[model samples]
Structure formats: structure tokens, C-alpha cells
Target: MTVSMTTRASLLTSLRMMVLLAALLGLLYPFVVTSLSEVVFPSQSRGSLVYDENGTIVGSALVGQPFVGAEYFHGRPSAANYAPDQVSGSNLSPGNATLRERALQEARAIEERDGVTIGEIPVDLLAASGSGIDPHISPQAALIQVPRVSRERNMPITEVKNAISSATENGGIVGQPAVNVLKLNLALDEQARGMP
Candidate 1:
């Protein structure tokens, strides 16, 4: 088969364009963006890792960790069980028997544990986040658990509430207030240790 000159030129032009776009978009663009992000937001660029007083990494500020003990405020119930590798929702329909049963059981547990009536429990406490690894809970969710956390930690309720307030990220105009459970717990630890 004979190839036309115009066809040959067009093929060469297409190949050159593809290589140029690949380099710019796939390689150079990512490199530039990553570099800028690292410089602009160091902690977040590195996973927003939370550290202890001893400079040991405990967890990331952006991901949730389960805190079942009474002394610590709990995060959302994770369908993925807070596993980063398995971040996902249960995908059960809202009316599914398993989902409803799980929520009811959790509500009862929270009532007994937090000493609050079922009606007082926040929805965030009973349901897992869509990512199933959300590090935050509603501020109301954190507040409702204050009694249990204060009693378990042997700390004053005011102090526990202060810690929650410190950990809370106020949504301001755009979103609802949320609390990072892991940071709050770590702050509680620091407070207990008399560290700033």
C-alpha cells in the first residue's frame, strides 16, 4: 500500500502532539503541582499526620480512628471499620434490615454509654460516613459524649468541653461544625499530661 504525503505528515504531527501533551500533562504538571503543594501546605501534603509530644506520629488529622473507651470521644461508626485501605460505606439501603438493625443497636449502646436518651443522640454517631473513614464528627456529637468522657478521664466537664471546642473546626458560612475525633483525643491526652 502506498501512503500519501499528506497522511504521513498528519500522522507525524499527531504523534508529536501526543508526546508533548503527555509530557506536559502527565509528567510536568504533576511535578509542578506536587512541589507547590508541598511548599504551600506542608502538613497536609504529608497526610496531615498528628504527632505526640514526643514527636511520634499517632495518626493522620484527615482520617478517623476508632476510640471505643469511655475516656475518649468516639468518631463515626465506619462500615470499613476505619481501615484506610478499605474506605467505603456499607452500601446498604437506608431501610435495609441490617442497616436499621445496626443503627438501632448502636443507638442503644450510645444511650447506655453516654447516659443520654436515644432522642438526644446525633445522627452522625449512629451512621458511618460515606468514605467510612471520616475523621470528624459533628460538634454536637462530641458534646453529647462529654459526660462519659469527663467521667472516664476524671477530668472536669468544662475542661473536656474546652478540648472539644479546640478540636472543632467551625464550618462558618459554608458547612456545619465538625470535630476531628483523633485530634480531640490527643488533645485530651496532652491535657491530662499537663502539656501545652
Candidate 2:
């Protein structure tokens, strides 16, 4: 009888500990972290949403969006199709034949589309970023597409080039200099409106 009572007491203690820890960790921990982030870094913590001229939410600066209109600069290729919930790298190694094939195929297509030879292409235009949904591209990548966009909108090349330059960021100590493709494209659209 004494042994059974001891076992019952131990089981009750374990059950109580489990419930307490579950409430503290499972319920409380997440709430604390999220609340702290919202307080400390409100805009970034909420996905850095970008707004259009009409106050409509267009896209988040945090993630890439696909652009195939030929009149805008394209962002890096996304493995998750620009879905924030599914964002991830391609996970392909340097020796992967599939990786090489995809790169080569993209190179050829870009050359045909942009009317540029293979050697003149910038590396960023051919490679996917680590996040796969990077919204920024190298300045060279943005500049190279200026001619195409200018011709499409019938705007002077200088104006399109200026918009891209204005959007390009130096990135400072965090990363390499790059232009936010979405912002540059939006500026291009604004300029294109009054084009001849």
C-alpha cells in the first residue's frame, strides 16, 4: 500500500509540472517574443509592407515578386515562387548538374531577351540569392535592363537610368550595393506615364 501511494504521488507531481511548463512555454513564450518584437522593431517585425500611390498594399519589401512584363527590371528567381510562407534557397550544391543546367539555360534566355552577349551579363542577373526571394538586384543588373524598359515605354534612356540610380542603395556594412527592383519599377511606371 505504501509503495502504491508513493507511485501515485510521483505521477501527480509529474502531471502538475508538465501542465505548468506547457502553459509557461507553449503559451507564454511566443506571446512574449512577438510582443517584444512589435514594440522594438514595429515596421520590420510586421513584414515591411510597401504601399502604392493609392494607399493600397502592393508588396512587402522583404520578399520578391515575379515581374515578366518586359518593361520592368526582374528580381532574382525564387524557389518558393515568392510565397513568404514557403521561402527557402534552392539547396543545390556547386557540383549539381541540375544547377549548372539551369544557370546555363537562364544565361541563354537572358542574352536572347536583353540583346546582350553572354560575357556582358552581370552575375546577379544569372544567379538566385540565398533567400531565393530577394527583392533587390545589383546596380549593374538594373542598369542593363534600362534600355529595354526605355524602348518599351518610349521614354528617354537618361530618365530611366536616373530612376534606377536613385533607387540603388549602397547597403553599407550589411551587404553589397543593390537597387530595390520593385521601387525602381514603380518609379519607371511613374515616368512612363508622361512619355512621348
Candidate number of the best TM-score: 1
Candidate 2, backbone clash total: 0
RMSD (CA, Å), each prediction: 3.6, 4.6
Candidate 2: list runs displaced more than 4 Å.
1-18, 39-41, 193-196
Candidate 1 structure quality by residue, lDDT tens digits, 1-196: 9877666557788899999999999999999999999999999999999899999999998989988787888899899999999899988997799998999999999888888898778999988799999999998898888988898889999998899899999878998788989999999999889998
Tens digit per residue, CA lDDT, model 2, 161-196: 888888888878997888988888877776656532
Worst lDDT run of 10 residues, candidate 2, spans 1-10
lDDT by candidate, in order shown: 0.90, 0.82
**On a 0 to 1 TM-score scale, where does candidate 1 land against the true structure?**
0.90
